[model samples]
Target: MRFSIYLNAQTPGPQEDVGIIQTLARQAVEATRAGFHGVVLTEHHFSGYNTYGDNFMFAAHLASQVPPGTKFSLAVAVPPLHNPMRLAQQCNLLDILTGGELIVGFAAGGSPLEYAGMGRDPGERHAQMAHNLEILEAALAKKPEDPPLEWETAFEHGTLHTRIMPSAFHRQSPAFARATQSDSGAEWAGKKGWYLFSAREKPQALAGRWRLYKQALRAAHAEEVVQDRLDWSMVQKQVYLADTSERAEAEIRERLVLMADNQRRSFGHVKDLRDAAHLKSVVGVSPQNPDEFLDHAMLIGDPASVREQIREYEAAGIRHMAMLFNFGFMTPETADRSMRLFIDEVLPAFTG
Candidate 1:
């Protein structure tokens, strides 16, 4: 199983503005030294979610400083907000800098606020996202002879044939889609025969999504994905560790509450994640007690306990587990401690 920490400062508010870069860099160094596989940063726009919205840029900067073995990735990027050519170039450059360790997670720019902030119409985002994705894929594939560019033609007085820069890593790096809620991600992942890194904290929802993914793959006739393809990871994330179950419960409460509240506010108005009728249920399932959430969403507890949980997920076909242990007010110290505990105790039990 592969383990990676999702990098983000606990809270970016005035009270806790120590910044994630310093802590994340330190954590990355520790993770690499400790033998963890990778670190993934998330991208968000115009939200207090994380002060650092440019995940690709941040990942690149961090990648340069990380220890030798640790890799870096952007969990998801708002595709419509970026020019595909420029985005591809930047990603390629990052991949080169990281020695070909880059896994791109593309998304259709969630959050209407991000779209509104960018002056993009939310209704047209999916189509626009599809267009941008095609351009990016074509650029990465080095299909330069392919033409009929619409977005570029409108901007040019005449004709402009532009190819992205630093395309060296185009053939080396792989890409994935962040499947959130809808089957759009599975459908697209299958359509492109690309990998899908599906993340769900909820087991039931995750099972449903996994089924949907298989269905989509079957529909698209996607070939058996290669394990070497970083994008094709079967990742199931949780906020868990090994200790007495009672002790685990005591440790994760406050942090979970803060995280759930932040989530409720972040996507509060976004109907895609939660409908009016289902909003309370969403929060209800989002454990007010971090340990309870851990029992359900995270893979934390005693060694025997966590092992059993992992076995269930492995049975469900999850090979890579992206454990989200550091969230809310989780200090870098605690986060590091959790990683150590998981590595030393919980990790050994599951070698599948």
Candidate 2:
């Protein structure tokens, strides 16, 4: 039952691209002040679809600005494209800067171009990613009994034992493996005792994934795991609150339409497999009907109505609900307004 904001930094087409970094940081500060538990920044490259280029570096910069107790997480760090040792070093630095508030989720790079552009084969990405992750996990779990070295000095020493930098506050900050549309990824995560993040699209598909993950966990007798700490999350793409359903519909309709259109444009270009229904279901978005938008993918309405929708998700075993303050290319003013309204009316009900 925690609320976090996912900042895509969605900028409208052909705009100035002005004041974006500052504006996003300001939103993070606002979410902290508004009593949100955390903020997750998504990683995208060359797509022009998301604003964050390097999430770990940006996270390090933002971690300094978050109010007293807010958690900071780079929702998923693409592991296939990084050197395992250097990635570990950067993560350690971020962990220190954030005062141990970082939740690091590693992924096999989702953008095939991100790998192919680097002259890597997409087919071997997962195996390489698994190898890199093993090294990272071992480095994070470093102990006094681990390897030591002696570097040659003027006095003729051998080699230097490289110390793990910026020691984390916990033994190791929690890490998750990004689950795919299928349950195999979820099952792998459960086998490793890591967290799982879900997209709202195809709730039934994600539910099946969760079922396999749970089955794997029980079959393996996972350590330090019970039903409570399965630690799953789902992202809700839109939210709005108003005095009545009528006002809510009026304000949210235009934004949802733009959002749905954006999704269609983005996904239409994605090769291999077009499941419009899955995309529509997950985002809780539909181009055809705004009234029934709430039925599939949103929590827009009066306090009672919004809460009732959230209750269904909560009952579905989603421990964390990530909210996008402004979906599509909505103006920041509108997005901020929605956040304030949600804070005033809807957010309290869930936390309480």
Candidate 3:
């Protein structure tokens, strides 16, 4: 099993922005020094949410500081809003900078405003993403195969007589992953033979998605995938460990619930959708009603109990757990305390 720290960049406001970034930089180094092998980030825009902002730049910043072995990933970069050719360029360039330690995931999940603000129609995001993916595949393809690459999309049009510069390590694109909360998306990801990343959801719901992905994955071609990659995939959760369950619950209800309220502010109309339950923005957060959030969304408990909970996931074929140890405006000191304990007592049980 593998564990990674999720840097939830829900900052309070602009006042403490520098402090937050510094804290995250330190946390990344600390996690790498510990047993955690990956650092996960998310992308959002204009919402005052996802405060670290540019995932690409931020990841590069971390790469300079963390050990060479540490991997940097954007769990799901919003493809609908980006020009496909540029996106592909960024991937290969960043992969080179990180010594081929970057893996990218894509999905069409984001708030409607995020699309509208970018002069896009939210309703068309799925189609837009599909179009972008087609172009991206062409952009990432190596030479000696096709004629000059010409592509068109709502936001971009380009003809590549020449190849993307600074070719990725070994002239291959970095390994790709896909994040999905929909049945169709799961099947599509499998057919592409990309890695899978699951958003927070009920265990049963996740299991169903996994089944679809796993079945399709086996039917498709996985040229470089290992058995371990098949088992782990990836899943995200808000996690906290303490000496007692009571203490963990109390702090989560206070901080995480408060974080939910802050998230709601940025979430805006998206929070009111009938099917918003699956929105990655909510992360299964329930404001004021922390018990509901606790029951459904996160992994919160004492170290021993948290270990037991993780055992359930491992038994169910989960080998890589992406855990959010900080978020919702939780103080860095407090978050570090929880993370350090997990590193000391809980992580070894599995990683060892």
Task: State the weakest 10-residue window (summed lDDT) of model 3.
Answer: 274-283
Clashes of 1: 5
TM-score of 2: 0.76
Residue-level lDDT for 348 in candidate 1: 65
TM-score of each: 0.78, 0.76, 0.90
**What ordering of candidates by lDDT runs from best to worst?**
3, 2, 1
lDDT (CA) per prediction: 0.62, 0.64, 0.77
Clashes of each: 5, 8, 0
Whole-model lDDT, model 3: 0.77
What is the lDDT, from 0 to 100, of the residue 259 in candidate 2?
Answer: 56
Between candidates 1 and 2, which one is better according to lDDT? 2
> Candidate 2, 294: how far from true, in Å?
7.6
Q: In model 3, which runs have C-alpha deviations exceeding 4 angstroms?
A: 142-146, 222-228, 269-289
Q: Which candidate has the top score in lDDT?
A: 3
lDDT of 1 by residue, 155-243 (tens): 12222255556665546344555545456665556555565676544555556656666666666663455334332454646554536
